[model samples]
Target chain A: MQPVIEVKDLCKTYQDGLKALDCITLDVHRGEILALLGPNGAGKTTLISIICGIVSPTSGSVTVDGRDIITDYRFTRQMIGLVPQELTLGTFDLVRNTVCFSRGLFGKRSNPAYVDDLLRDLSLLNKKDQEVRTLSGGMKRRVLIAKALAHEPRVLFLDEPTAGVDVELRKDMWDIVRRLRESGVTIILTTHYIEEAEEIADRVGVINRGRLLLVEEKHMLMRKLGKKRLTVQLKEPIARIPESLSSYDLDLAADGSEIILTYDIRSSRTRITALLQDIKNAGMTLKDLNTSQSSLEEIFVSLVKEEA
Target chain B: MNLEAVKVIYRFEMLRTWNTLMQSVASPVISTSLYFIVFGAAIGSRIQEIDGVSYGAFIVPGLIMLSLLTQSISNASFGIFFPRFTGTIYEVLSAPVSPFEIVLGYVGAAATKSLIIGLIILATAGLFVPLRVEHPLWMMVFLLLTCISFSLFGFIIGIWATNFEKLQLIPLLIITPLVFLGGSFYSISMLPPAWQTVTLFNPVVYLISGFRWSFYGISDVGVGVSVMMIVLFLSACLALVWWMFRTGYRLKQ
Candidate 1:
């Protein structure tokens, strides 16, 4: 499928000569959720701002659904909905008016019914007449989402949508995002929460400093880089891992209560059966055994660390 | 041109004015009325006429112009500045609307508010002094041109201002003094020749003189020069605003 948004060789240099983005290129597919995972000051927001046309890039070009963002700004902007990281809303305006006005800003005709449905979906229908400033922080974030979707954009960019939000609101936002994706809207969200990316992202891109380190299917990435740890609980405390088990990448607990064996999942033979035999031969009695796979968080950290 | 976008922004801004009706409309009207009472009723009683026009009537145009200029700048500057302060300007900047349309909506609404206040003051002035519009057409022309030009100037100040203090800076230190020195009360011709020449350099003089000429058919400067001066200032303001949007000065990161 043709990408809904294409960013090519994008670079940004601030007035003080701090390079915010360096030759970064990316493509966002239609109707897919792509989570950009980055640390603070990792240029995620800068990239989003450039694509949304809030900040101009130093060099390189971006095209949304085949339209240049700069040359065809009006049409290109109409195709995008950006829920900024900041909670920026007109405090005095009614919830309904704010959303409808956003639609009008995109040159869309007034659609009261559509706006009503949007507010209802976000659980803001009851407060439609209330002033935005009266709403809670979470509700204000929902209003931001409602306004962004007011124009029925084809691509939605959520910049740290769950930041500072309570768990309940985060769950609600996840549900809303799922619904938007079901409606065929392409989503690109920036987040520092690895769990969030692991939970919802179809594809995850890890960026650090000013460069995108890697982008891969979430499951594929996990399977390729994921390591499984075989943890064994000894019947009694041991002073250390016996020399016989030293061939395996083994770690001994400081208290000598357990042993951890690490191995890649993709290896043709995990040699778990052999390792088990070796442990038995070493005269160690395992009271319990369990295995845990590495999470996306670890993969992200290692990727950033490798670059650093 | 995205007329719908312009209308949305314009309506939003006008609605804000209505929400602050006491500040936006009532305050200016009441304040200008005080000027009518002090300068018109009390002061006029002492000085019967100036250049054959009643003292009360003579100051009417100047008073209206003063309020119009100050109110126009305040309204437009505050209109844009509030959005910047609250970071809500991102919504407008990210929208499909063009810069020209954004300016039209904001400046248009600001000018409309000032015009409403100007008209209210004019009506209130009628209660104190018998007013005449010898060139009714010219009076309207001056009123509208003044509102638009000053509103545009306010827009520039809005973009240039980085803080609240800066927002009120130009309107207070620069504009208020200019209007006062522009013969909002007395004619420049009454001043010494050198002082009159210096007063001629003040742009506000042209605005007030031309507006007063429309009312009583008398002016410190020729009506043609006043019109030309206003047009020239309007063009300069428009050019500056155009450059601001093109360069994304303060509007874009």
Candidate 2:
């Protein structure tokens, strides 16, 4: 089957002479989570804004569920849900009224049971009649989600969903994301937190300065770019490397506490055996040793810096 | 304009405006009462009937239109300005609702408020100075036209305004002065010919004169000219508002 959302050669240039997106091409599957990560000026919001039909694209076009976003905007807009980074809500409105009005805006008839179930799922049933202005920050966030999901769109775009949230609220939002995923909703998340993408995304797309650096499945990207470091703790602090051990090519950390070695994961020869032999020949005893791999965060930083 | 979408937005905006019925009813009634006490009693004492009607009865129509225009401007301008200020407009923009529907909702609500307040102020005037409606249907027609025209005018101000101060600036600096000089309190025939010709430049004179003609069955300006000028102004305001929405001028930017 064709992907749920396809962008051919997407480019967006504002009238103020800002190049927001530069010939970006990507596809999103039906149910997977695609996390788009980038720096501050990285065009993440611009991409989502274009897809949601809010901003006018200078060039290139997007399609949702086989409908062109520009040509068939009304139908395409009906199929997409967007949770903007900004918390925009009618504060004087009641929670239930707010949700119902949102659903009605899309020409949906009044479904009291559907609205009640939505509020109940978001844990807003108790605050249904209370004005939104009286709600806490976390409750307000949930209200935004409820409003976005009111029309039951097939795809949901969350732009920096957890930007100002605390730990507990972040966990709550993540739980909601999981629930929506289970309900067969495709999620596209953009965030400044690399770990958010690393923790929950199936595929990661790193963008910087209006250009996409990489887009790959999480594990495959890790395996392809993963770096391993082996650290060996010495039994006795070595003052210096012996002349006989000079071929080992290792750096003794400051305070002469440990030796560090770096190597690629796909390499057949990590040089561990030769290094162990050289250490034995030099009469240095190894107390403990372990190998570790780099995380998505390290890869993200490297790519962003490379783009810069 | 898609009628269905426009109807949906109309319901939403009208309900939101009606939600403040207390402010809509109370403020205008109180302000019109003050107009009756200060303008009708004090100013009428020095000014005699110039058009074969009591001074108190002559200016009532103009005062009603003044209240209608000012409140309509406030209602529409603030109605659109608040959504932009509080960011709720982003929600409306992202929804399947079109800009035409948004404008219809806002301008319709403003007209609704203006018409309701116009009726209320008229009822309040009956309590202070007795009113005899010479042509009741024409009176209603003028009320409807003034409400809708000024409501559209207010819609234009809303689309152009960027802040709260700008929202208020047009009514305070432009609308109020136009009403004051538009013969709301005095007949334009009382002015010299040069000043009378200059008063013709103010669009609001036609609205007030037309409305005053509805009440007394006579006016300083011809009724045909007054109605024609108001219709032209109404169409121009609507076109400007439509252009603003179509181009997404300050709204989308």
Candidate 3:
């Protein structure tokens, strides 16, 4: 099956000689949630802006649902819905008209029912008649989502959808995104919170300094790069790691109340048994032990740092 | 270009404009009425006809043009500027609506507003000045031309402004002073010959002069010159606005 969205050799250099994007190319499969993770100024918003047709590409092209964004802008734009990072709305506009008119702007025939259903889904039914300026921040963000979904586009781009939102509202928004995916809408979202991507995205793409770093499946990435840490509560406090055991690169913590051993999960020769034997030989016993695999947040930080 | 899109956007834009109808239409009508009350009744009582027309009658055209110019510019400028300042413009640009649709929705609404307010001011001027129209159809043609011209100008200003403060720069500094100094409150013939020569440089004087000609069949400046100046200004503003949309100047990013 063809990817729902294809970006090839995309590049953008602003008039003032700022390189916001390099030769970035990637395929976003249909009906999957893909998270674009990058540091600030990592070209996340720039990429979305270009695809949305607000910013012209300095080079390359994008195809949405097999339609060229530039040559077939009307058709291509009809399939894309973008929630900009800016929480901007017509303040004096009513909830109903905002969404309905947005649908009409796409040349779609009036579908009051679709708009009504969308408003209900976004929890905006109550505020449909109210002025937008009077709505809460969370409500405003939801309205943005509603406006994007008004035309029932197949692809939705959420540019940092959860930024500057309260925790409860963030969860609510996450649920709405989940429902949208269940309806077969391909979602491309950018996020500063690694855990958001980890929780919802089927795949992850990391970008830094206008360069594509890596793209991989969420679970596979974790399994391939994740390191395990064994926090062993020592039976007795040891002042320091023994001279012979220093080869393991262990950390003796807080008067030896615990010891930390970090090693790759993929390594078959983790000296766990040997370390236990050595601990016994050194006249120490474990009080307790627990293992933890690396998190996506850690991997993201390390990847960004490595790129830098 | 799509009529459906235009109607949708126009209705949305019209709704926004009506929210401030008092500023755009009603307030101008009321203030222009006072101008008739004070200028036509009190001032005209002493001053005779300037050109075979009562002092009250002479100021009617200028007063109508005054409301038309100010309201048209404010309507179009604020219509575009508010969207930019509030960042709703991004949503519009991101939508499938063509730039033409955005332009029409805004400029059309402002032109409609200008027409309404211009007519209202004319009607109110009648309650005091006992105004008479020799060519009612010509009045409409001239009024619409002025509306389109100034609306285009304000549309360009809106696209050029970066902030709320920037939006005020042109209307307050440039448009208002031009209208006031353009013989909107008086005839250029009353000024000294040197002052008339200086006022010739003010483009707005020509608009008022031409519009007044459409009403009374006489004007201090030649009607041909006023019509030519108006056509030139309108064409220039239209070109700039189209260029703004084509290049996606400040609107796109």
TM-score of chain A of each: 0.95, 0.94, 0.97
CAPRI class assigned to model 3: medium
CAPRI level of candidate 2 = acceptable
Q: Rank the candidates by DockQ, best first.
A: 1, 3, 2
Give me the chain B TM-score of candidate 1: 0.99
Ranking by TM-score: 1, 3, 2
Interface RMSD of each: 0.8, 2.4, 1.5
DockQ of each: 0.85, 0.46, 0.63
Q: Could you give candidate 2's per-residue lDDT for residues B1-253 as a string of tens digits?
A: 3354456566767777668767877888898899888988888778888678888888898889889989989888877788788877766676777666777777887898789889988988888787888888988888888888888888888778988899899899998999999999899999999999999999889888888888888787888998899889888997888788777787663
Question: What does candidate 3's lDDT look like per residue over A29-70, in tens digits?
Answer: 999999999989999999999999889999998999888998
Model 2 TM-score relative to the real fold: 0.93
As for lDDT, the candidate ahead, 1 or 2, is 1
Rank candidates, lDDT, best first.
1, 3, 2
Q: What C-alpha lDDT values do all the predictions have?
A: 0.93, 0.84, 0.87
Per-residue CA lDDT of candidate 2, range A69-116, in tens? Answer: 877777888788888888888888889988887777765676889999
Which 10-residue window of candidate 1 chain B scores lowest in summed lDDT?
B40-49
TM-score of chain B of each: 0.99, 0.93, 0.94
